[model samples]
Target: MPRHDGGEKPQRSCLACRETRDRDRLIRFVLSPQGEVVPDLDAKLPGRGAYTCIDAACLAAAVKQRQFGRAFKREVAVPTPDEMTAQVAKLLLERVMGYIALANKAGKIVAGGSMVGDALKSKNKPGLVLVARDVSEAIGEKIAAQAAGNNVPCRWVLTKDDFGALLGKAPRSAIGIKSSGFVVQLLKTIERYRNFLGEVQ
Candidate 1:
């Protein structure tokens, strides 16, 4: 069946670029009989399928290693590394994004530092804070205090500066000066951290 203009949008994320794109723009693959790997251009398959972006290098990485083996928990022979990478990237992207969607739907998110502060003031603030590692110390401290005062735990998002780079447009500003811009996907990230902390506690 042909998809209409308003029909479902097929999406896939690139492992190499850490970007989400339309599924049609990517390649799909499935583990075939006799351990041979097969590309599922039509996306119809009986067993598990994976996807990868058009990056040949990433495809190479996927095939030379245990990427698919770990994902599927079985040693399925791949004719080419490229085939394995496509399926692994696709499966990983979907798995990650699906959890994000679930967190969003559960209202476990609060984006923007100012908005987060407001949530602190509100009756229901988050139980955890995910501050960017590159965020200014003064700003980070203040946010930390708010979380601490509320009995919320504060954690740096990651050790690498890439976390800040990946934050896109999230602002670095004085607390009372102006509002930090909103990021849709960041809410899911923060919520995931919150859940992670909950599990540890």
Candidate 2:
């Protein structure tokens, strides 16, 4: 599985901007059997690989300037910028959700509103506070405030129903991740997605 982390990462130059960045900061691409360019989100695809900054304009620049053809050393079909960007965003979002599930299974997740609130106030604070979108407005605001007071990152992600479905349990209004590994990677990936979408993190 691919991940975003604070630790030193593999660096590569973007085929579009020709700028060097961490591997997690760029999206990877590879040539397909049918002579077309495809995104290798996992970075596990075989053969030579191309990289691009996670920006729509950069992707467009690559297509317009024939960067892919030059890098791959052959002609290859590439999707329109809009199509490619959408696909990247979709894959990134899926990775985020998958991490949440893995964390829960690893027993690093603290679920339920009361438990999450208590965890935030304890000496051993959680790495992150995740508030379901469907949580009660008052409860959400309170938890958000608590997290802010504790200098914790509070991200409103999937709804209560969705969280429940993913964890195979009853609805969860709020949750906390206790593992440092999960927190760093989740924060990095969340920021990456937000940056790619031109949203302030």
Candidate 3:
């Protein structure tokens, strides 16, 4: 664990890349009593923890070099590279989904196609536009164009069913996120997810 300065969160080095970053930006792993490497996504587990950037390439390098044993300073059972990647990806996706749900609950999200379009056109523009993956190309393009015109970030990753479920609606083709502190956190989580999947440079 890296030492904290004042009230700032501690920084930790990636076991593979060895690059120091805020602990929240890295994934944490702990050695269980059974010697199994367990992901402590919340970083609340009671044990010595190893850190790794939330990236597939970094994870691959760590697995290839068998760094877990060295990090834990003991013989630990590490999952296969594929399994590890899948597990991490699953956890990240769940987190992103949870954030979307929270934004909706907090009245920070405007769902439904027309509502989102209007929100984008309003003088009080949203900070982000989320289009469902399965949305028609015409609608998606329109939303993207509107967002671009307003200098707002646009993302199309979740399916209609996924977005709808998060918003507690039947199904939505588009949604708008109001500019707020939560939007910043949501965007950061999305970027981390993209990095983990190698979807962005």
**TM-score of every prediction relative to native:** 0.34, 0.79, 0.87
Which candidate leads the pack in lDDT? 3
Model 2, 66: alpha-carbon shift in Å?
4.6
Q: Ten consecutive residues with minimal summed lDDT in candidate 3?
A: 1-10
lDDT string for model 3 (1-201, tens) is 556778998899998999999889899999888999988888999999998998988987897799999988889998998898888888888988998888888989988888988998889999988888899999999989989999999987788999988877889998888998777877887888888998877
Q: Which candidate leads in TM-score?
A: 3
For 1-201, candidate 2 gives per-residue lDDT tens digits of: 255467767788988888988887788899999988888877899999899987767777887788999999998988877787788788777877888888988888888889989998899999899899888999999999999999999988778987787788899999899957999888877776666676743
Angstrom error of the Cα, residue 134, model 3: value is 2.9
Candidate 1 per-residue lDDT over residues 1-201, each given as its tens digit: 244477767686543444666776555667877766666645788887666555555456656654656555688777576455445445544443443334444555565567678877887666555666667788788888887888765666542243223333344331111112223343434443333223222
Candidate 2 has a TM-score of 0.79
Order the numbered candidates by TM-score, best leading. 3, 2, 1
Sliding window of 10 residues with minimal summed lDDT for model 1 = 173-182
Where in model 2 is the C-alpha error above 4 Å? 1-11, 60-66, 133-138
State in Å the error of residue 91, model 3: 0.7
Give the clash count for each candidate: 4, 0, 0
* Candidate 3: pairs in clash: none
